[model samples]
Target: MTGVVRLRAVDIEDLRVVSALLQDAIIPIADMAFLPDAQQFVMLASRFQWEGRAPEDGPTPDDGAEAATRINCAVHFSGVTAVRRRGVDLRQRGAFLSLLALEPSEGALLLRLSGGADIRLEGGAIECRLSDRGDPWPVPARPDHGLD
Candidate 1:
């Protein structure tokens, strides 16, 4: 069902699918937390679309149909992870989490974050699930200003 996306595979394609879901999402930093001690990065995000459209190509939140398709997502990546953040402060609130790129490296999944930073997780075993909540994804008060 489109309303509920369950992905449990630990494969390259799985990572890509998860990446696609998170593409162009404006995730709050408070909704994300990285536990270096546990080697896990957990995030709750409101993903506008998982159709893999470019940010500019995706429907605006004003588009009622597409906006209703938005899903609240949860992503979890674990296994001997290492994080390197560049040009993004963990202190930032309501930051946009642009998944710049995803690829296979050293037998692991490499997540290229926006601002030239990256996170490498030990297996491609990233888990992502999605569901449409009672309400649609909230549009920012200012156009495009939601980006951090």
Candidate 2:
């Protein structure tokens, strides 16, 4: 059966889990794309504002400093909050997975196991799949720009 899941804001706690998941699911796929010293990867899943940053003023100097010190640019497997759906298997449960950051224009995003792993972006209507057979995750195509 089909279901709906919504992704909310992500926090430090969530980042912990996302980090592990990213290591498990993304590292082998990314291979040398990431640096060995890099502890995290920045991710832009949807539009979300930093707690202290205002819509008008942007991020503070402290934000930048903190991010830089903590390898903030990287996106880790933030965390998972589940919504059980009857008849769905253990691997197919609905979840609101967290990401580090995303452009404001992209709305909400959901992560679920559909065959392998899938990232479903709301407004963009984009679905990215990571092959279970150990293939790399498929990057979503960017929307048209100047041509449009």
So what's the TM-score on candidate 1? 0.63
Give TM-scores for every candidate, taking all chains together and pairing residue i with residue i.
Answer: 0.63, 0.17
Which segments of candidate 1 are over 4 A away from where they belong? 52-68, 122-135, 138-148
Model 1 worst lDDT run, 10 consecutive residues: 60-69
Per-residue CA lDDT of model 1 for 1-148, tens digit only, reads 1345656536667767766666655566788777879777777767655452234544643433332345677777666466555566777785666656566677466667666766565643444344334444544432232556
The C-alpha RMSD in Å for every predicted model, in order, reads 6.0, 16.4
Give the runs in model 2 whose Cα sits over 4 Å from its true position.
1-72, 81-118, 121-144
The lDDT values for all models are 0.58, 0.27
TM-score of 2: 0.17
